[model samples]
Target: MVLIDRIRLCLEKLLEVFTVFLLIALTTIVLAAVGFRLLGASLHWYDEVASIGLGWLTFYGANLAAIKRAHMGFPGLVGSAPVALRASLFVISEIIVIGFFVVIAYYGYLVLDILAWDRLVSLPSISLTVTQSAIPISAVLFILCELLSMPGAWAKMRHGIDSEHEAIEEAIRMAEQDLQESRS
Candidate 1:
C-alpha cells in the first residue's frame, strides 16, 4: 500500500508537470502563430498543431480534474441523501464512471491500431496514432486516478465523511452565514 501510494504520488506529480508543459507549449504555439499572422506571415500548420494541442489539453486537464474531484456535477442530490444511500449511490456512480472509461479506452486502442500507419494532415512526420493517442492515454490515466482514490472514497462513504466535499460545504456555509450577518 505504501509503495502504491508512492507510485500514485509520483504519477500525479509527473502528470501535473506534463500537463503544465503541454499548456505552456500550446500557449506559446498559439501566441506565436497569432503574432506571425498579424505580421502577415501566417504558419500553415498552426491550426493543425493548435487543434491537436487543445485536444491533449482537454484530456489531460479532465484527468487532473477527476483526480482532484473538481469535475463539474450536481452533487446536491447525493449530498442530501441518507448516509447509507449516499454511499451506495457513490459506489454506483463510480462503477459507471470506471466502466465508461474502460470501454472508451479499449475502443481508443482499437482506433490507434487502425490509424497506426496514418499521419497527421499538416504534420506528415507525426503519426495519427501519436496525436490521437491522447484519448486512450488520458482514459488510462483517469482509471489509475480513480483506482488510487477508491480507498479514500470507500472510507468516506462508509464513515459518512468526505473531507473534500465537506470542506467546500463548510466554506459555502460560512460565506452564507457571513452574508446573513452583514445584512442583519
Candidate 2:
C-alpha cells in the first residue's frame, strides 16, 4: 500500500506538470493566432494544433482525475448494497472499467495504423500519429492510475466511506489548520 501510494503520488505530479505545460502552450498558440489574425495574417496550423492540444489535455487530465478518484462514481449506490454483495459489485465494476479502457487502447492503437501515412493538414511536417498517440497513451496511464489507487479505494469501500465527502471534510480540516497556524 505504501509503495502504491508513493508511485501514485509520483505519477500525479508528473501528470500535473505535463498538463500545465500543455495548457500554457495551447494558450500561447491561441493568443498568437488571434493576434496574428488581428494583424491581417493567421497561422494555418493554429486551429489543428490547438484542437490536438485540447484532446491531449483532456486525456491526461482524465488520468490525473482517476488517480485522485475525482471522476464521477456511484459510491452511494455501491455503499447501499448489502455487505455480502458489496465485494461482488466492487469486482464487477473494476472489471468493467478496466475492460472498457483496454478496448479503447486497443482501438486507439489500430487507428494509428490507419493514419500511418497521414500528416496534419495545416502542418504537413507533423504526423497525425504523433498527435493521436495521446489516445492510447492516456488510456494506459488511466489504467495504471486506477490500479495504483485501487487499494485505498477498496479499504474505503470496505469501511463504507464516501471519498467525495471525505475529500470535502479533509479540505475543511486543512483550511482550519491553516487558520490556526496563522493565529499562532
Best by TM-score, which number?
A: 2
lDDT by residue (90-153, candidate 2, tens digit) is 8888899899999999999999999999999998999999999999999899899999989988
Candidate 1, after superposition: displacement of residue 65 in Å?
A: 1.3
lDDT of 1 by residue, 78-103 (tens): 66678878888988889999999999
Measured on C-alpha atoms, candidate 1 has an lDDT of 0.85
Which window of ten consecutive residues has the lowest lDDT sum in model 1?
68-77
lDDT of 1 at 85: 89
lDDT of each: 0.85, 0.91
Kindly report the root-mean-square deviation of model 2 from the true structure over all alpha carbons.
Answer: 1.6
Q: How does model 2 fare in lDDT?
A: 0.91
Question: Can you give the TM-score per candidate against the true fold?
Answer: 0.84, 0.92
Single out the weakest 10-residue window by summed lDDT for candidate 2: 78-87
